[model samples]
Structures are given as C-alpha cells and as structure tokens.
Target: MKSEPEYTPFELMAVAGARELKDGEIVAVGLGLPVVATFLAKRTHAPHITILFELGVVDPEPIHTGVGLADPRVWYRAKILSSFVDMLGMVLHRGLVDVGFLGGLETDAYGNLNTTLLGDPKGKFRHFVGSGGANDIASSARRTIIIIRHEARKLNEAVSFVTSPGYLRGYGERASAGLQGGPSRVITDKAVFGFDPESKRMRLESIHPGNTVEDVLANLSFQPIVPDAVSTTEPPTAEQVRLIREEIDPERVYAG
Candidate 1:
C-alpha cells in the first residue's frame, strides 16, 4: 500500500480552508494563509474562483508567493486594476463578493475578532496591525471565513476589542445591526468550527487528523458547542500535496 504523504500543519490548514470555497464565487482575500488557500483552491478544485485583494487587484494570477496584496507578484495578470475605493466601495460594499477570508490575533465564541491590541487601549500593550479593510470585508461579504492559529490565549470568551463584527451579541443581533452575513466557519490547525444556526456560537464541526475533541477543547479558552457526530477533516490527497509543494509554494513562503 502507498503510504500517506507527510504534510505540515500550515499545509493542512490551507487545504482545509481551500475546501470551504466554491467554484464561480468571488472571494475577498486578505494576506497570509488566506491568500495561499485561495490560490490553492483556484489551481485545484475551484478553478473558476475569483480572488479579490483589498488593495484593488481582482482575479490576479500571482507569479509567486507575495509579501502582501500590493506586491508586484500579486499584481501579475490581474483582470481588474482599480482603485482601493472602487474595490471596497463599488465591489465589496455593494455585496457582490461571495465570501471574505480574515485572520486576527484573538476571536470569541461569537466570532468577534480583535486584530488591534492585547490589553487596555490606554495602557502599554502589544499592538498588532490594525484593520485595513478587514472590518469592511467581514461586515459586507455574504459570508466570512476566519483562519487563525489555535491556542488557548487566542480563543477567548470575548475578544478584548471587537475590531470586526462576527455575530455581535449572537443570533438575531447581526441581522438587527443590518449586516448581511456573519462568520460562517473558522479553520484552525486542530479542527473546523461552524456557527450554530440559532445560537450563533461557534461549534466544533470536525477535527483534523492526529487531533481529537479533547485536544481541541484543551486549546480553547471557552467551551465550544460540540456536536455528537463530529467528523475528521478530509486529508490532503497526494495530488494536492504535490501541487502545494511544487506548484503552489515551492519556496515554502506561506505553505510551510
């Protein structure tokens, strides 16, 4: 029998995130793993997936792994080279984008994200890159997917500050605020979580290979609703692994 291919946690995370996207859907992609995931999706299963960068490149075929959205590599072969205002206001704010991918320093049960600071705003604290267009994309996209590292400190009962709205107070609160959609799924190294339809709280949907419910629970600060029939995340196929290693990110910039 052929043995399973070795893959890193980042590769697993990217593949898992890529699977959430569908063909013919327009996705507002951010930097880091979200960029890698969307590229992998376009190269493989969702060939028709449209990728839009916050800096205003639409359907760009990046020549190589990019440092950020504005990198020249990301601007290669772009279908639309427009201004930031046009992209965010005309495209995103109009609700044309199907999904938005985001990352943050902290997230809560309601999926509220804090990419701002670690402690009280008035006190000395570790500061992170503030929201550029993350807040706008998260609020206006039809659905949003958050990708973050899984750790007890990063997963909180409530983020220190709500940089981007998720379900707000949960359930009807998001709709009440007139937001079209809220966080739909969260992809992590250990597991996959989805929001409970009624409660709007994050729930354990599936665990990644080599991880268990106990492992996931141990890393999370708060108790996430667990379904009885949690499934294992689909492992990356040999072909997918090959594409990621050789074609997608040979330098191991984001795929590592």
Candidate 2:
C-alpha cells in the first residue's frame, strides 16, 4: 500500500521535534505533534528512543499507523501497561524520564505555559479541565521542549494560567518548586525560539523556510529580539521529509 503525502507545516514541526531526540532517551510526549515526532524518531535513527505515554505505556512501536497511545496498536507494541499511581511515582519521584515534549494552549515571553484553561480568573471559564500529568512531566524531565502554532492569539504577552509551570516566578525558582526542567526550546510555525540567559525572556533563534524574520516578528504579540545575525530554521532534509510524509500521517497532514 502507498502512503499519502504530508501537509507542509505539521511535517516541519514533527521533524523539528524529531531531530532533537537522541538514542536511549525517554521522552514524555503529549498528543499530536509529540506522537508524530516520537514515531518518526523510532522509524529513523533513534529506534532506541523510548516514548512514555501519559496513559502509562513505553516504547510503543506504532508500525505504519498514525494512531497513538489510544490506538490498539499501542497495547501490542508497548513494553508495559500500569497505573497512573505507578507512573506518577516513576515520573515525579523515581527521576527516570529524560526529556518532555509538551504542547501549549498558549505561551508568553516568559515561557510560562497554559494548556488546560482558556478564558480567565474569577468568573471567566469558572471551572477548568485543568492540567494533566504535564505538571509532573515539566517537573521531572531533564529538559523540556514545547511545540505550538505561531500567532498573536496563541503567543500572548502573559499566560492566562501557568498550568504547566515554566520557570515559575523565574528560572532557578523552578528548582524551588521541585521542577527539574522548564521549557528549553519553543518551536513554532514561523520560527524557533529559546529563553535568554540574563533576561529570562524568549529570543528568536531561527526563522522557518519561506518566511522572513520580519514576518515572524510581525505576527508576535510582543517584541521578539533577533540576534546580531539570526539563523534560518534548518529545513528537514530529504530523509526527514520523506518519513514524515510517508509513515507519520499518510492520509492527510496539517500545514501551518
């Protein structure tokens, strides 16, 4: 059977995250982009990369299917199936996971994340679905990576709720909260961004293909500073583009 083509943007984001994985690393991946990246890494160079699903499965070889942890395939491919109690204990207390790949409802210049709620405090969106194990994922992983669609609405000046707990109050303060690793890189539709050492703010590192640095900056809600000589986001090589298009989401892929 032949696999369908990939839409450009999702492929880009998946490749962006997939390229970061190292063999033998275990990533606590969120849904969607996380799923694509993990599977892509598995098929390519990092077959040893272990992916820990929040639902408590590990290193599921998804074959050619696009389904995730919920897919029946996961049960067959997974090494273990356990309770949230055991998984939480392992994730938060045992110190086992290496990296966390999380998605955000929105992110701010400070890198604080909001994924569970939308509206606000007091009466707006009164009760919330709330954050998932993301709190633990952020607290335990050695490093964190965030994937989000780029836009003014999704990238705000300040987060509505610090649900996922970026550098609470500030960077070192996360250590005080017992959070091991806060967001290290935030990849988006238009560019790649990271936290500045001194200011603890996000700065533009690279722009995506077909988009100019000015275009990325213009779409952001607040000012995003560029380095003296900003670099372009590396395009996915022919290898990455092929796997993402073929095996990841063969039916149809999403674009930015």
Candidate 3:
C-alpha cells in the first residue's frame, strides 16, 4: 500500500484555499498566499477563473509570485491592464465580483479583518500595510475568502480596526450598513473556519491534519461554533504538490 505524500503547511493552505474557488468566477486576489492559491486554482481546476488585482490587473498570468503587488513580473500576459478606479469602482462596486481573496494581519469571530495596526488606535500603535483595496473587495464582492496565520493574538475577539467588513457585528448588520458581500471562509495553517449563517459567528468547519480541535481552539482568542464532528482538510495531491513546487511558486515567494 502507498502512503500519503509529505506536504508543507503552506502547500496545504494553498491547496485548501484553491479548492474554494470555482471555474469562471471573477476573483479579486490580494498579495501573499492568496496569489499562490488563486493561480494554483487557475492552473488546475478553475482554469477559466478571472483573476483581478487591485491595481487594475485583470486575468494576468503571472510568471511567478512577484516581489510585491507592483512588481512587473506579476503583470505578465494580462487580459486587461486598467486603473484602480476601473477595477474597484467600475467592476467591484458594480457587484460583479464573485470572490474576494485577501490576507490580513488579524481576523475576528465576525470575520472582520485588520491589516492596519496592532495596539489601540488612539494610543501608541505600530503601523501595518493598510488595506490596499481590501476594504473595497470585501465590501462588494459576492463573497470573501481570508487566508492568514493561525495564532492566538492574531485571531482576536475583535480586530484592532475594521480594515475590511465581514459580517460586521452580526447577521443583518452588513446588509444594514449596505455592505454587499460578507466573509465566506477563513483558512489557516491549523484549520478552516466558516461563518454561521444565522448568527454570523465563526465556526470550525475543519481541522488540518496533525491538528486537533483543542489545538485550533487554543489558537483563537474567542471560541468558535464547533460542531459535534469536524472534518480533516484535504491535503494537497501529488500532482498539486508538484505544480506548487515546480510551477506555481518554485522560489517559495508566497506559499512558504
């Protein structure tokens, strides 16, 4: 009998994130692991997925995960190279986006994100790379997918600031505030969390292999709605691992 292949947490995270995307969906992809996952989906399952960058890059077949969002290498072979206004105002706000793929410094039970600062906003707070169109994407995209590290401090009861609105306090609050889309899932190295449809609280959908429910719970500042039984995340297949190692992110730019 053959045993399962070895895989890194980053590879597992990327494959797990990629599986959430569907073919032909227009996805607003942010920098970091999300870029890797989105491209992996396009290469394997979601070939027709339309990738959108905040800087107005649409359907760009990136040669590699670039040094930064502005790196020229990330814009190679684009279907449409446009402006921020066109992508955010014209496309996103128009309610045409299917999925918003993003990463942040922190996330809360409500799925609210913070890429801004750690300490109290009114006090001495260190700055972080602020929401560069993440706010727009999460606000208008039909659904948003967040990928971030799983740590107690990073998974707070509430984020320092609401850089991107999730359920925004509860179930009807987002709609009350006129925000179109809400967070769909939060994928971490240890687990995958989904929001409760009624209460809008985060719930443990699955735990990554090698991690237990207690392990996942211990990393979160707030308790999530865990079910009686949790599924294990599907690990990356041999082909997917090969693609990630050789094609998608050979340099370990983002997936690592």
Which candidate tops TM-score? 3
Candidate 2 clashing pairs, residues 3+ apart or interchain: none
Model 2 segments more than 4 A misplaced: 1-7, 63-73, 126-129, 169-171, 253-256
Superposed Cα deviation of residue 243, candidate 1 (Å): 1.2
TM-score between candidate 1 and the true structure: 0.97
Off by over 4 Å in 3: none
How close is every model to the real structure, measured as TM-score? Answer: 0.97, 0.88, 0.98
Model 2 per-residue lDDT tens digits across residues 161-205 = 887777765546667775666778888978888887756678888
Model 3 Cα lDDT, one tens digit per residue, 1-256:
7779888999999999999999999999987888889889999999999899989898877776688879988899998899999999898988889999988889999999998888989998999888899999988999999998999988988899999999978879989998777999999999999999999999999999999999999889999999999999988899998888889888987766
- Model 1, 56-117: lDDT tens digits are 88887765877877688888899999877888899899889899999999899999999988
lDDT of each: 0.90, 0.75, 0.90
